[model samples]
Target: MKFQQVYFVVDDSFRLLWIGGEWDESALANGGSDARSNEVLSTSLLSHITDEPTRRATQAMAEAVQDTQTALRIDYRCDSPTLKRRYLMTIQPMKDNRVLFVHDLRDAQTFPVTFSQWRHQPGADALKCSFCCSVSLPDTDWTPPEVLAGPHPDVVDFTLCPDCEARITEAVSALRDGRKPGVSTTSGYGPEGTAS
Candidate 1:
């Protein structure tokens, strides 16, 4: 997925301020027409985030960055029907308590078998991580959508699974303690590399 490094800025209150770097192209390609910069500017970042846990975790990361005045990096997955893409997001502190989010494409590969297009289902019973795209059923463990046995669910509640939550907690804790979060390609969630 030859993505052009995308970046966006937020105000002290986490309101969308500006976005650049192929944002429109990426949004369109990822079925995010309503998420375009023009459509989302001035809105609360939490409004665009579908999951409560993700929202709270994002806030914690940003706050940690602000307090530590250091950049925090984490890897995540953004997949398409035929491609699996990895991205690294850096949350950097800026002057005036604002934050800058920079997303760089790390790697991409074609899926062995193309996944059917997934549609969002409001009020669905299934759970999915907005960051890693892992899905959890009523009683099943969090599993990658690629490994699921059947077609993707029509809708899923976008929230962090236990693993993702733990990852975020660890990363934020390191930052709050004035440590740099390490970068790792091993997991498509938060930092797994040795903290420095």
Candidate 2:
């Protein structure tokens, strides 16, 4: 599907000078519109981005706004309800004023989520079980049903949300502070008089 685009000028001081695709009819008349094709762009339109690299580029821009030797490129998204917007920002030296190339990211690879949404998300390649490499979750009720019944902290006694993580960090910290494990008074026995 074809994607729409817009551009915003960033000045030497990192100020928003002018926006190219501000729902202006002039841009549409000038053939700068991405709506040439009748493709239906959904409300969940994507953003063209990579997080870490963009951060570094912005930092470089902050420090080297005056140096011709340094150049910065930032590809960011615009939060517009009317349409999806992605911009490729180029910060470089010009003879008179600092120039920012605001190219439309229509054909660029897109992510359905924005950068903020992606960062906030837990991630797909995360630790499947918080128990770590050595630990495991038992399905037995004696161990508590919360861990087995659903995704909740009640699985662990005292309701530790991330019992595995807590244990790992606590173990390391305890070793550093030279401490011993505490005893538990609660019995592990079942209704049939299993081991307590």
Candidate with maximal TM-score: 1
| Position 21, candidate 2: lDDT | 49
Show model 1 residue runs off by greater than 4 Å.
25-33, 184-196
Question: Taking the tens digit of each residue's C-alpha lDDT, what string does model 2 give over 19-120?
Answer: 554333212111123432223122111111123222333434433534543434433333221223333334455544544444443322333432221111
In model 2, which runs have C-alpha deviations exceeding 4 angstroms?
22-56, 61-66, 69-89, 106-196
Q: List the residue pairs that clash in candidate 2.
A: 147-155
Error of 1 at 141 (Å): 1.1
lDDT of 2: 0.32
Cα TM-score per model: 0.86, 0.30
Worst 10 residues of 1 by lDDT: 25-34
Q: State candidate 2's TM-score.
A: 0.30
lDDT of 2 at 103: 42
